[model samples]
Target: MTEQGGTCAIPGDHHDTAACEHISRMLARISDKWTLLVVRTLGNGPRRFNALRREVGEISQKMLASTLRDLEENGFVSRTVTPVTPPQVEYALTPLGKEFLCPVRGLAEWVVANAERIDAARASYAERRAGE
Candidate 1:
């Protein structure tokens, strides 16, 4: 990498600043609750539309469809449609999506592992607030 005007450019590349910003925005997008849940559900295996909705729970049809579209656009999920008397659609993780599952699962496991500590902290904060 080379530094130019306080911005580091990767070898043979341009727009490092823009790339960083874009990646940050993408991270925020996928780190959202709906996205994470959708990705996690898909991690288990391919799922049809209605099945995905039921598994994710409480996500409106519109929201789930939107989330799946976003994930598909991002190349994190693959959508396949089979034709017959009626069309059948299934959603599964792409290679990229499967790669993302590792970190998401790790983060989820960490949250579960720390839930008690987090609750304790929240309770302590609430007590302090009550005193105030």
Candidate 2:
């Protein structure tokens, strides 16, 4: 009964923005530059906070903390604290986050596979610009 491509269950109705906020948040959480790197690093195994900082070079402490908190809230990662001396804390991916690995890894592999061509395209554009 609905018009073509209308999202609402009722006829001729539009999609509700508020209804989609959760998905919006989910997409935003994992799509940021630092988020992808952090998740990918955690996919390997649990690592101490310092190790994460080292692996993600150039990232500020505040950014790392915020990113981890978001991922933890979204159920993509787990944070554990140990009671031993110095009180250690570490992070690792949840199974949900682990599920994101193969597809993202494929994307990285595709970039590697096409890097030469992409570089050549950029170089060609630069040359053309310089010639003008």
By lDDT, the best candidate is 1
Q: What are the models' TM-scores?
A: 0.85, 0.75
lDDT digits (tens) for residues 12-94 of candidate 2? 44555443554556667778888888888887789898899999888999999999998888888899999999899999998
Tens digit of per-residue lDDT, candidate 1, span 68-88: 999999999999999966899
Model 1: runs farther than 4 Å from truth? 1-16
lDDT of each: 0.90, 0.81
Backbone clash count for every predicted candidate, in the order shown? 0, 0
Regions of model 2 farther than 4 Å from truth:
1-24
Provide C-alpha RMSD values for all models, in order.
4.7, 4.9
Clashing pairs in 2: none
Q: Ten residues in a row with the worst lDDT in model 1?
A: 1-10
